[model samples]
Target: MSNKAQVLVIDDEPQIRKLLEITLESNGYEVSLAATAKEGIIIAANHPPDAIILDLGLPDESGHEVLIKLREWYINPVIILSVQSNEDDIVKALDNGANDYLVKPFRTGELLARIRSSLRIKISEENNPLITCGEMEFNLSARIVKKNNIIIKLTATEYTLISLMVKNEGKVLTHQYLLREVWGPGYINQSQYLRVFIAQLRKKIENDANHPEYIITESGVGYRFVCKE
Candidate 1:
């Protein structure tokens, strides 16, 4: 396959490896398969695939360990392909670094769609330079966030959550969606985490954090990043 995009498929099962390789390749993506997490890491370091399709169960090192290693350095769209359907497993994968996930037996079409969405997000983010809301300015390129020209320090997770919300500014983001996208799927039930982060962000950007004019809450659902009309 050529021109679709390079994808690295890491799975310990030979049959599974062949299945994914054939599917991705036939669909026009160049695919590389690794049977072990160690090999996957080496391939990722050396080749730098455009995206990753990783199976959570590996023969040598577990997928979580591989994800941690990748998160320590690499930053690309990663989709987890796993038989582990447990909520904890999914959440752990998302929190560790996966951009998307698929449980075993996922249809080829669904997998491809997810991969495209992930890539689309990465490309869109790369193209974004700056976003402004009233006196607040968010510079994605510089990774700096400011209000009234005063720089504010946002924790890594805070920045992630803010960016996610800002990208969907003016749209009502559901609590489940926001928590899953930013923190992880397991965190959807953890509204307090979202509240704390939003409170912190509001304090830094809004004149009154308690009032929270910039980050507006939409009842019990989620929040909206207020934008100038």
Candidate 2:
């Protein structure tokens, strides 16, 4: 197999596909193009790529439907590159298992960065199971969490939230993503629930809940788990 990371670009627009092909190929990546959702799905199923750039609009089928079908078996990153700028669309895409959402007219630099970030997280998860930050340690295989070498108690929801964040450490997980993953798809709009649980989680894990170092809130966007030592 070629060492170059492969990327599938699924878009109805020929120009967009061509542009992504050039950009991705120049960045030392292998590129595949599909002009419709059906074609994209077939290509993806036949030859899985390291990552996917999916457009939300397609001629035959909605890209959201395509994403749902892909997530049934496709484990790699799928970034939404769409013209929809509304929050609901973005949230819906992320809730449907998209790794990241980037509206159309995106900066090439930012798009590349998002791809790298997604790939990095996927690789790290496959290779490592024991995650540690500061005095906190998480043994994913055992579902055990320790702080300062002492066992700590957490509610089921709290544990789920923490594990999700830790798994996506060093990446900004949007409110929609976290809510969907932890509370399910129906609760995507319930940001206050996340706030309450996050507060409780911080109290249990952080040395100082007043100034958390582990979970950093991204203001209006979401929260990120900072695990860098």
Candidate 3:
């Protein structure tokens, strides 16, 4: 019921937790700190935060395991904070369900920016129950898509992809971004997955799959969902 967005920082390092607490609080956020993974999970389940900044290296368990468990029920953004800078580690964490990643010794400005961006999207998704554009309509709360007032069936993956694109309508979502959001960062290199899914989506929503008016491909870049505001 507090107007300010609540953030939970789950990290063992006191310095990191203090820094995050100060930064997030100064930015008008209600902050909570958990030094262990078990404590983080318990606090989260008891009082869910608007966003979470989780460290990969935890004393009790791997942050990856924690992220997986949170994603099983927690829908809010969970940004990974770690010292691992390798591409494989970044991709692995993302694939496991992290919303974003920030390496250790990170810039506070960028961290705030990522949190703001993620929270903005989450807020939109939660508040907007129905979205209309051209012949298509999305019942975001129900996870339902319809065209011309007729219900259209979609696989969970497809729905996830389309919903992401739709939520970010008119923005050209890069292949890496879409892949990270859809199949996780591990699939960032899998361009074919996007192509196949895009094709299937077009077949279902577009009047002519060959010439789609809703989902536009950026040719070597990514895809964008075009709609009238």
Which candidate achieves the best lDDT against the true structure? 2
Give the least accurate 10-residue stretch of model 1, judged by summed lDDT: 220-229
lDDT measured at residue 34 in model 1 versus the true structure, 0 to 100 = 92
Model 2's lDDT to the true fold? 0.88
lDDT (10s digit) by residue, model 2, range 31-81: 999999999999999999999999998999998999999999999999998
Give each prediction's root-mean-square deviation over alpha carbons: 9.5, 4.6, 8.2
Model 1, residue 212: what's the lDDT? 77
Winner by TM-score:
2
- Model 2: CA > 4 A from native: 127-163, 170-190, 193-221, 225-229
**Superposition TM-score, candidate 1 onto the true structure:** 0.60
Model 3, 1-229: lDDT tens digits are: 8799999999999999999999999999999999999999999999999999999999999999999999999999888887856556656776677777778889998688778767866766656778898989999899999999999999999999999988866544667888888999799889889889999999999999998999987554467687743
Can you write out model 1's per-residue Cα lDDT over 1-229, one digit (the tens) per residue? 3466899999999998899988988888899989999899999999899999988888798888898889888798888887946656766777677876777888988687777767766776655779887898999878899888889999999999888878756544666778888889789889888888888888877888878776877554457675655
The order by descending TM-score is: 2, 3, 1
What are the Cα lDDT values of the candidates? 0.81, 0.88, 0.86
Show model 3 residue runs off by greater than 4 Å: 126-229
The deviation in Å at residue 107 for candidate 2 is 1.6
